[model samples]
Target: MVYEIGDNANSALKVVDRVTETLRGDQWQPTVSVNEAREKVRIFVKQTDGLVDGLVVMVVGEADKHHGDTGNEAVFVNIVGEIDPAELGRITKKLNIDVDV
Candidate 1:
């Protein structure tokens, strides 16, 4: 799933914090990475009974890298494998970003 959570770097970091902490609380270990030059944050976790097991990639930078706009972001979540429907819903809720479709 892909979500737009605004383009504020601070907010993006907060989102990363919330996600990691929430997963930790659920006993799911998460590996995190941050790319300074590209302004990207990445997270990986194993799917657990109550946690998402997937890779989360957050890119924060100019929406129009070619001059469209500035400060834009897109977050992507890649589920590593199959999971229960309910678990998927729970994961989305934790991410806290609304899906338009």
Candidate 2:
């Protein structure tokens, strides 16, 4: 799975494709971990159609504790089988956002 912190929908989807492809294969568990700098980060994966048709990726991040706001942010992405690295690269370039891992 792809791990990223995007400010919008399009960029978040691109990050998912990029991360999923980079860690392809059964041995690679779909997981995303936000660094300690982030107050909180949670990733949830739900398999649809018996894990074949596609997957739902949900990411949630909490506001920085120092900011005095306890709100949270979230991003959701739906992915079909196989990701195109070229396409992902293009989105990454356009969005200018970094994938966590």
Best by TM-score: 1
- In candidate 2, position 38 carries an lDDT of 40
- Backbone clash pairs for candidate 1 read 46-53, 47-53
Per-residue lDDT tens digits of candidate 2, residues 22-77? 54543344544444544222233334444533333445454565878454455555
- Candidate 1, superposed: residue stretches over 4 Å from native: 1-7, 35-38, 47-55, 61-71, 78-80, 83-101
Task: Please provide, for model 1 over 68-91, each residue's C-alpha lDDT reduced to its tens digit, 9 standing for 90 to 100.
Answer: 554566566766765554564466
Distance from true location, Cα of 38 in model 1, Å: 4.9
lDDT scores in order: 0.56, 0.45
- Residue 3 in model 1: shift from native, Å? 4.9
